[model samples]
Target: MKSKKKTLNDFGGIMYSTDPSFVYEDKNSSPVEALANNQQDLRVMLDKKNRGGKAVTLVTGFIGTDDELDKLGKMLKTKCGVGGAAKDGEIMIQGDFRDKVLLLLQKEGYKVKKSGG
Candidate 1:
């Protein structure tokens, strides 16, 4: 999936621009650099804030393209047999699956760590 694009309302700088044709860069404008699988330092944790009491396993600190992030999120969701999404450079898997996600990431050759209690 493609990264979410910011609207004019989301940028403070955009408000001050007088040029009608001026275009602020989308966050994903740059070509994402590919990090070596071994060099990836990913944090896996369960979060409940903003979602009532439900837990969502969040995997953050990914340095890659939206395509790469989506691929990884898809792999994790498939492995865990759950639903989730990837956005803003973070992957949110629905449920507390840190341990399982950690293993999946490790098997994929990424350096994974469990965070939070």
Candidate 2:
């Protein structure tokens, strides 16, 4: 069985357009270019909310394509030897590895900042 991918309903439930000049545009058609590592501003934070009391290190503020984000996430996970996820411009590390992640990102030339307490 093939899985269906979900997409935005940009038509707003409109069935037809009377105007001949009306053209449907896909806002997400263009992919966002990935920024340089040094130009990327990233934040590493430890979050415990909505996941019981277990803390997870979240890396946010990544301005890049999904593939680049996934690669970075995979590298972090492999280096730290932990499981996590990366999506919607955010990377979630399974544990409180803020210091480690910060250093790793710095070595990778990313401008990283530690956020939250």
Root-mean-square deviation of every model:
4.5, 6.3
Clashing residue pairs found in predicted model 1 = none
Question: TM-score for each prediction?
Answer: 0.77, 0.80
Clash pairs, model 2 backbone: none
Cα error, candidate 2, residue 80 (Å): 0.7
Residues 29-90 of candidate 2: C-alpha lDDT, one tens digit per residue: 56678889999999999999998999999999999878899999999999999999998889
Candidate 2 — which residues are off by over 4 angstroms? 1-9, 16-24, 27-29
**Top of the candidates by TM-score:** 2
TM value for model 2: 0.80
Error of 2 at 103 (Å): 0.1
Give model 2's clash tally: 0
User: How well does candidate 1 score on lDDT at residue 51?
Assistant: 97
Q: After superposition, how far is residue 12 of candidate 1 from its true place, in Å?
A: 11
